[model samples]
Target: MDNASLKKRDLAVLWHPCSQMKDYERYPMTPIKRGEGVYLEDFDGNRYIDAVSSWWVNLFGHSNPIIANAMKEQVDKLEHVIFAGFTHEPAIDLAEQLVAMTPEGLDRVFYGENGSSAVEIALKMSLHYWQLAGKPEKTQFIALESGYHGETTGALAVSDLGLYKAPYKPLMFDVMTAPSPDCFYREEGESWHDYSLRQFEKMRELVEREHKKVAAIIVEPLVQCASGMRMYHPVYLSELRKLCDEFDVHLIADEIAVGFGRTGTLFACEQADISPDFMCVSKGLTAGFLPLSAMLTRESIFQAFYDDYEKLTAFLHSHSYTGYATGCAVAKATLDIFQSQPVIENNKVLAQHMAQATAHFADHPNIAEVRQTGMILAAEMVQDKKSRTPYNWKERRGMRVYEHALSQGALLRPLGNIVYFMPPYVITPEEIDKLADIAWQGIQLATKD
Candidate 1:
């Protein structure tokens, strides 16, 4: 179909995520035809660099041949099978590799179809684990203010972001929120390290008060994606880990966005030197080739539900495509690429280059803050630097910068006034320069006109 015709059809028949349909009049969606190595080509053949990793996936860039070949081989052999009654080599092997790569003590894997599903699974697993261990009163979870888990009802219950969960509160379960790792908005003159410790202190107090009812405390580790990429010091997470152990609360690390080298480490939790009781991982797990998530847990937690069939005490949750052969094969191959290629080391170099380039804008008149960890970076805009006052979200400064970047052939989707980058690991030092140049240009266009 012609591009115009397709656009008209889409406008008539589809609803998109995080978009105001009325705003489509001024900002139309680009019809992309092809993508490769961190770039997208439109239907009319205009090119744009994928600076956000196509929503922070596409780890090896679009369609790496190794993963693609693995999927091809798997589909030709056995596409999918019922995961409950059957098991496969790819799933078992991938799980084994994941267990080996992850921090110590996490030995069981539960596959779910999406990030939200994985989150729900983790929450349910944690809650059920406690129930199986004879603590049925522990059902509530401790999440962070401005934290985002996902859109599912269970996941939404733990998330406090109004943009995603506000209207659904009537149907959601109970959750208590603590201060996030948003150091940028912390009290003036207080160091981030101090701020982090205080936040953890409050969380510790809350868990102490509600230990009987709280099942788990969930976090995004180094990068809080939906809350504007808020970063934190490792000391805070280490203390949080200790508190969880002290209070006997399960720690769930939602590594959906920060896993697989995004944070310059294989997993962001690694940097903190803390192993959570459960981890929700997806997004880049299959290198953006497919939708799959795995909620990994310690063997102790898994063992709680290891009873005979009649008890129904067994954690009974299953998805039909739980161990889809193709996804498992692709995930396996993707993990192989991480070892055969210098993905993590290469990202360390890229992160350093990004830091140097982004540092130039730290003093820009419109820039309020530049926060980064590894390849992940955020540029927060504000009206008053001294006060750290953010522009009114209603004014849409972030949206403006985003549109300008799109017009200039670079995709940098901003979260509120925070324009950030989470580029593919394959990006070279030269491309890093290209991204910074375009980002600065977009900033100028956003502010000037």
Candidate 2:
């Protein structure tokens, strides 16, 4: 069907996530026919670069050959099987590979379907472990003020973003929110390290004072993607690790968005040279081809529940497609591509090019900050550069940039006023420059006033 017909049918039957249906009246849905490499073509043949990696999932590229072939092959052997009492080759191999590659001590893997489910699994596991260890009072969780984990009941409880969680507050368990280490609000003269270190004091105080009741302290290591791509120093992670160890509280690293070489390392915690008690991974886990998430935890935590079935110590969690063979096979293929190709090494060059390409934005009168972390680059737009004042949410300035980008043949989705680029790993330097140029022009028009 054509774009108009598809959108009409979609709006009649389906509702998109994180969007208001009313907005579709002004901006019709863009139906994507197919995608190749870093570009997606709509039904009407209009092409746009997949700058946000289709919500930060696509790693290698759209319809990657290796992953496609792997999934296709696995489809014939075993699409899926019961993961409770049975095991499959793809799932076993992926688990072994993950345990080997992930940070030390995360030797067990519990599978889920998506990022939010992964967060729920981690939260449940942490709480269960504490109960099994005879510390049932440790039922609370601590998260950053602006942290965004997921939208499920358990995940939403730990998340502090008001936009998505405010309405659900009545259903969620109250979580202690520590001051965000988002260095964007730091004093002008303070370095990122100093600012992050200073802000860590807040978390330290909160955790230390309430360690007895805190089951785990969850954080999006290095970069907080949903909170406007807010980033901080590695020292904060290192210090948090030390504090978690000292206080006997589990540290859950939500690396769903920042893992798999997105943050210049295999895992963001690697940048801090520390290991978390629990690490929730998804998004790029299956190269955006299929839904798959895994919550990796320490052996001690796993052992806490490894008791007799009748003792009620076993952690009971199950998803129908927990260890689907196709998802596991494609995930294994994604990891294979990472190891076979110079993906991480190449990203360094591409990241440098991206920085240099958008360097001109630093002088933009309405641009507030041009922050970057490896493959991700964000430009924060403001109403007044001197005061770093943001545009009202009702104004939807970022939507202006989004509309402008569509007209210019690049998909530049902004988080509020922060326009970011998180293209597929296969994106070329030339493609990077093209996206940067489109973003620059779009920003100019959005903030034109």
Candidate 3:
């Protein structure tokens, strides 16, 4: 019932994701009892703002009444059924909406339980499509350096982040890596557009050489979230799309983190005026209400798998909870909220407030860069600002900031040395100021010797 008791029980039985279990001995887990509109209440009745949107999944807010009511109504009627042949109205309706909302040419929808599974489904589908088209040699994939797709074997194989994929390298299939278009790596006095265009040469060279063996190229669209919130220009996507078309390679846009108006646009690919072959979406699909993910693809790719069972060309990938009625209903409600309210327009104002609130960090001596991409903003902490020398990862500087922010009643989880804020759409401008103030204090505490 209380924080201490719950911590003891949880530590005894639970293994948390992306955490070193022994660290819990020093920093106890936060026992959240309930959440409401950008705030999570702990068992002790202390409230902390959900600055990261509960791992960037939440959209409208935590415990949103609209989504909750839809879930309740759907569960009352029908909770779930096997998705093999028994289809329901909610599932069918949600799929239709997703196909319509996404960019043109994405006419088919495939269901999965999570983002990683969605990426795996796309990867398998691309390879299988090539096999059925008499090009079995097109078996390889290309990913951006430091890009993260997911943790599954197929997803990890396409990802280039060593932190998650190093230990499992032997288990993963080989993948080619292209230099990231992250603007952080751009030279002095260079524009993001120019640098991104320059970076595309590496990808062009790689794809041109290996197009015959490459099945697809997977990217995280505008912002590479898992890679410390590193971002790039929209022009990169436009050029990448052209290159893929020239080389007959499929472009898979992993919009799991940057989709659903997080990148200022409904979809990041829209800013580039391009449509990817496979669009993997999740996280905010159900507004953090349930586990649901979808892979939207073009009709051309879908047709490659539409063959007789005797030919063994049918795609057999599936999840037991694929297209759950409750999840589908919640997703429909989430979309309804988008339609009813000016979510994207409101976010534009909120994003301006965020930019103004954190602008002071740009002058801080220990802060290298203060970057903003729509609702997501990050301030990279460095040991020296001029040289941009990063603090040793072993020092755990980001953890110090996290602990400080927790004491100040805010949940500003840093991605390594990069402190960031990705608040829900329901957050007000005043709330943005509060989080900015807390983050500033945390940064000072973490930077002090």
User: How many collisions per candidate?
Assistant: 0, 0, 0
Q: How many backbone clashes does candidate 2 have?
A: 0
lDDT of 2 by residue, 390-447 (tens): 8888898998989989988888888998999999999999999999888988888888
Kindly indicate the candidate among 1 and 3 with the higher TM-score.
3
**TM-scores, all models, native as reference:** 0.97, 0.99, 0.99
- Per-residue lDDT tens digits for candidate 1, residues 98-201, read 99999898899999998999999999999998888888999889998888889899998998788788788899988898888678767878888888887788
Clashing pairs in 3: none
State the lDDT of candidate 3 residue by residue for 1-449, as single tens digits: 89999999999899999999999997778999999999999999989999999999999999999999999999999999999989999999999999889999999999999999999999999999999889999999999999999989999999988889899988989999999999998899999999999999999999988999999999999899999999999999999999999999999999999999999988989999999999999999999999999999999989988877898878999999998889999999998888899999999999999999999999999999998899999999999888999999999999998998888899988899999999999999999999999999999999998
Candidate lDDT values, in order = 0.87, 0.92, 0.94
Query: Model 3, which residues run further than 4 Å from truth?
Result: none
Output the better candidate (1/3) by lDDT: 3
TM-score of 2: 0.99
Which regions of candidate 2 deviate over 4 angstroms? none
Task: State how far residue 110 of model 1 sits from its true place (Å).
Answer: 0.6
| Alpha carbon lDDT at 346, candidate 2 | 95
